[model samples]
Target: MSAIVNRLAPANAVVPEQQPSAVAGLRLETRIVDGAEWDRTIAGFDEVCQEQLHVFATARWPSVKQEPMLFLADGQVVGGSLMMVQPLPLRIGHIAVSKWGPMLKDSSAPHAAALRDAMVEALIADYAERRGLMLSVLPRAALETDNSAYERLLARGFKRGSELGFPSRYIVRLGLSDAEQRKSLQQKWRYHLNKSEKAGLSFEHAGPERMGEFDRLYAAMSERKQFPDHSAYDTVPLLMALDIETLRPELFFVRHAGEVVAGALIFKAGDRAVYLYGATNDTALPLRAGYFMHWQIIRWLRDNTRAGWYDLGGTDGFHGLHQFKKGMVGEAGVITPVPPVANYAARPWAYLLGNGAFWARDAAYHIRRVVTGALRPKARPDQAPVVVEAGQP
Candidate 1:
C-alpha cells in the first residue's frame, strides 16, 4: 500500500498511444493495481460509482477486501475495475465481486467489444493467477434491459444470470424539470410527494461527520423494519476513507418541527449518483419523508454533484420498499440487474469447483428466465427472442 505508483496521462487526454500486440491486432495489458495506481486507473476511466472506487473496495471492515485492477492498451490506462473479495465458507479461496465496472476510458471505440474481450480475458487470467478460483461479477450494467456485456461474458465462456439473487433495480436520469419528473411517477407516488412537500418537512445534507446520526437511525429503522441482519459491512466507513471531496456523499435528512425524522445517503463516482442507503421512522412514514428525501436528493445531484444518473439502488421482493423507490422515479429511467459472470481460476481445486457450480448456477437461472419469458407478454409487436440491447458497455 505504501508503494509509489506510475501516473497515467492527464484528465483531458482521451487517446492512448497504441502499438502492435503479440496476438496480431489485439493489443492490451491487464495488471493488478495498488493504492495510488488504482486512483490513477479510475481517474482515467470515463464512468464509475463510489462502490467501484479503490477506497470503497479496500475498506477496513470485517470479511471484506479489495483487489483493484486496470487494463492498458499501448501503455495508457484504458480500463479499470474493483473486485470485492470475501472468503467463501468451506472453500480455501476468496470469492471476488466486481460491481458496476471494468469501466473503460472510452467504451465507444470502433473496436470496443474486441478490446473489451481481450482486456477482460487478461483480467480473468490475472484473477485466477493472483486471487481465487471463482470470480462473481455483475458488470455495472442494467440487468434484463441491456445485455451487451452479458453476451460478451458468454463469448468468454463465463456462466451468467441469477435467480432469487441480485435485487431488482431502479434509476433516475437527471436534468428533467420538477413537473416533468413528477408526471412520470405512479399516481399515488406523485400525490405522496406533493403532500410531503406541504407537510412542513425541511432538508439537511452532510458527509462523514453525520455518519453516527445515520448509524443510529439506521439501527432503529432496521429494528422497526426487521430486515435480515445486514450480511454486509456498513458502506459509510468505506466512503469515509476516500478522498471524495469532488464525489462527496450527500446525506439528506428530513426535519419537521426541527427534529430529524428520516434520512437518505447518496454516493457518487465519476458522473453517477447512487442512493446508497436510507431509513424512515414511523413518525416520518405518514409525513412521507422518504418521498421528500428522494426529491431533494435528485435536485442536489442535478445541481451540486454534476452527475447524470441517480441509482435508487435495489429493491426487495417485498412491495413496501419497491413502491417507495418507484415513487421516486417521477419520469426517471430504471435499470434492472445485469447478469453475473463467473470465471474460474485454472488451479485444480478452482477449476473443479468453478466448472461444476458455476455452470449449474447459470443453467438454473437461464431455465427460469426462459419459462418466465414464455409466460409474459411481449413489449413490442415483432419481439421474439431474449435479445440484448446492442452497444452498451
Candidate 2:
C-alpha cells in the first residue's frame, strides 16, 4: 500500500477550494488538465510509477478531484505532476498529495540533470514556494537519495516525513537463482516457509473473478488491524480492466485443508511487481499463511513471470507488517524511503492537523486493540513487535 499524506479540501467537487496560484516570473508556461492526455505525456519517462498513471489517479480520487499539472519551459514539457486534492474524512480542510512524481525529466532532451534542475526550480517557484497550503510529495527514492536532488529539494523547503511507508518501499531484485533467493531471506523466514510448505497450502491465481473475496478479506483485515488501506483507490474493477501482459493485478492465496486462509493482491507493471493489498484470517495466523502467500508470489515473479523486481510494500514501524517483509526479503532487499526533503513543509495548521490525525489514528487503534484484547504478534525471539498491526505480520 502507498503511504498517504496530503490532499486539499475542495469546497465543491468540481473546483479548487483555494484559487489557483497565478504563474509569474521566468518564461515557464504551465497547464493543468483532468484528461487522457496526461497519460500520453508521462509515457516512457525513466521515473515511471503506477501511482503516476491517469487511471491510478482516477481510482484514488473517486470521491475527490484530481488535476494533472505540467510545467513547460519554452515549448517543451519540463515537469509533469498528478495531484490528489481532497478533504480528510472528518471535515478538516483538505491536503494535496503527489506520490512517486512529478516525473522531473525531459525525454527528448540532452543534459537530463540540468533540465531536471531547471524544471524543479520552476516547480518550486510555481507551487511549493508560493502559499502555505497543505502539500506533500513522496518523490522517487532515486531522486531523494542522490546528492544533487537531495540538496535541491531541501533548498526548496521540503521536510522529510516518516521513515516508514510512502517514503520507502521494500524492494527485492529477482535476478537471483531460486537457491540464492532463498538464502537472501532471514534464516527463520526460510524455516517458516518450509514449515508452511509442510502444511500443504495451495496457491491459486484468482484474479478479478474473486474480487469480492479480496474485498471482504481486505476490509476485515483493515478493521482488525491498523494498516492504512489505499486499496480502496486501486479497486478490483480498475485492476481487472487493465491488459494482462503489460500490467496485471494478481491474487494468490494459501488454502489450508480445504479453505482459503490467506491471500495477496499484487500488480505487475513492466518488469516489476508491487504488493497492493493482502488478507488473512486471524484463526489461521499461526499457520504462517501470509508467509506462504508472499513467498509464493516472490517465487512466481522470479520463475513464472517476466517481472524482474518485486516490491514487498512499505514499513509500518517495527510492527508485524515491516518485520515480515524484512524477514522474507532480508538485508539484500533495498528499502526506498520517500525522504523528508521531498515532503515539502505544510501550512502550520495543516502540519498540526496531519500530525494530529496520525497520532489520533494510532491512539484509536491501540484503544480498540485493548478493548478487543487483541495480542500483538511476536515477530521473532530477538525483538519486541511494534504494536501497530497485529494481524498484518
Against the true structure, candidate 2 has what lDDT?
0.60
Task: Show where candidate 2 strays beyond 4 Å.
Answer: 1-33, 39-46, 62-64, 70-79, 85-97, 104-115, 128-135, 142-148, 156-168, 219-234, 242-248, 270-272, 303-308, 341-393
Error of 2 at 79 (Å): 6.5
Residue 171 error, candidate 1, Å: 1.0
- Per-prediction TM-score, please? 0.76, 0.66
Please tell me which predicted candidate would have the highest lDDT against the true structure. Answer: 1
lDDT of 1 by residue, 1-393 (tens): 643333332231222223222234455655566766676557534566666666655553446777676767787666777767766446555656667666766765656655665656655655665554566666665523556665566655566544334345667778777777777677898888889999999988876788788788888987775544433336577566556365456677889997889987777655567777787777998898888888888877787765667877655343566567656654456645545554545466765665565556568766755564466423111322222232111
Measured with C-alpha atoms, the lDDT of residue 31 in candidate 2 is 68
lDDT string, candidate 2, 72-180, tens digits: 6666676667876656667776556667656664433554444444444444444443544456666555412353455455655566554332334567768777788
Collision pairs in model 1: 100-140, 101-140, 143-336, 143-337, 143-338
The ten-residue window of minimal lDDT in model 2 covers 9-18
